[model samples]
Target: MRLGLHALGIGTGAEPAVIRAVAGAAERSGFATLWAGEHVVMVDESDSPYPYSDDGTIAVPADADWIDPMIGLAFAASATSRIGLATGVLLLPEHNPVIVAKQAGSLDKLSGGRFSIGIGIGWSREEFEALGIPFERRAARTADYVAAMRTIWRDDIASYTGEFTTFASIRVHPKPQQRRIPVLCGGNSDAALRRVAQWGDGWYGFNLRDVDDVAAKVATLRGLCEQVGRDPAELRLSVALREPRAPEAGRLAELGIDELVLVASPPQDPVAAAQWVTDLATDWQ
Candidate 1:
């Protein structure tokens, strides 16, 4: 199994130089990928429940400057050649599909096909409101958006007429190096699993605490793939480890996990945090 690191909770105080240095170090340390997280805007701390945490609170610095993941990945792409770039979970329904497809294609082309898109429907209702997207019908909208993006990626001239999106025949140039850029869906719901089987090249397991659960989910995902007439082996299994434990690695591998990404905790010093990730990558290997 390949070991990767998720650059989460890393302070936003670091300068561009620090970001590039850390990303390059990760690449040199033989990490398979460098992943990052995103949250466009945070609402005032209220009763809004943070989905990842039990108490419904975000653990990271709310005042810390936020950077766009696409732009950050682009910077990382320029800094490293081997390490793949990914958005731990890009909220698809929150953005325009056309723009996203174009940007993603550009990144893939520029990165020499070393980009994997991990997407989700998003959990924050406040974020949806802030983006001016309705919370209702988000799942359907996300599905159509993904379908439209695939059309844009695969066709020389793409046109789509959907309930939420419509476009005429337009040529999307500078096609990606990969015929089909890998789409990895993240979520643990049954609907999320179905989406993975229907549209994703892989399924990303989030909030997964144990390997037995991962194995069972993999079985379900495989069954869904078979039901959809897709080859089960074509579906990759990746899991996000909220807390890294060495013993869990073997169990994850046994559960057929291809990649394991450990979330980073905030460090007192940004440089120290980056170095910590570098050390973890080296030690994990």
Candidate 2:
């Protein structure tokens, strides 16, 4: 199994220099990938509850700097050669697929086929509403969006006439370096599993506390893959670890996890954040 790191890069803490330094250090340390999260706009803490956290609150500082993950990864890609660049979870339903496909293809082409897109349907109803996208029917929209993107990426002249999206035959320039840039689906819900089986190259899970539970989820995912006539082994299994619990790494590996993404706590300083990444890489490796 490959070990990697996921950084929130929250606050004014991660400047360009620190990002470059951390990317270089991670690539040098033999980490397989460097992942970052994205939130176009943070919701008002008082009105919107964070789904991932137990307390229904935004954990990071309200003033934390938020950069576009695709742009950040593209910048990091220019600084590192081998480490994979990925969105920890890009809220796909919020953005336009054609534009995303263009940007993602450009990044993958520039990165020499080292980019992977991990996407989710998003959980913030307020953000969706504010973006003029209906909070309901997000899943269906996401499915069509992904399908359209796949058509755009793999076909020469693509045209999608979906319920939500319509485009006449068009060609997206600068095709992805990889024939098909890997799309890894995020979330553990049944709909998410079905999405993985239907379209994703991998399944990305967050806050997986139990290895057995993960194993079961993988089993369920595989069953869905079988039902869809897709080979189970072709679907990569990736999980995010909140902290470095070395004792659990072995168990995770034994569970057939292809990648383990370690999430770092937000740092107060850019240099400190870079050093924290270096230290974690040194200690974990």
Q: How many steric overlaps are in each model, in order?
A: 1, 0
Off by over 4 Å in 1: 8-10, 46-48, 265-274
- Report residue 226 deviation for candidate 1 (angstroms): 3.7
Question: Which RMSD does model 1 reach against the true structure?
Answer: 2.1
Shift in Å, residue 244, candidate 1:
2.1
Which RMSD values do the candidates have, in order? 2.1, 1.9
Top-lDDT candidate index = 2
In the range 161-208, model 1's lDDT, one tens digit per residue, is 999998989888777788577888888777889999887888878767
lDDT of 2 by residue, 1-285 (tens): 787777645554256776776787788878898887777766556466665666767676656787788988998899899999888789998999999999999999999999999999888777787798887988899889888998899988999999889898899978999969899999877888999999888988876656766878888898899899998788878898544476777888877789888876536565676677778877765
Question: What TM-score goes with each of the models?
Answer: 0.91, 0.92
Candidate 2 Cα lDDT to native: 0.82
User: What pairs collide in candidate 2?
Assistant: none
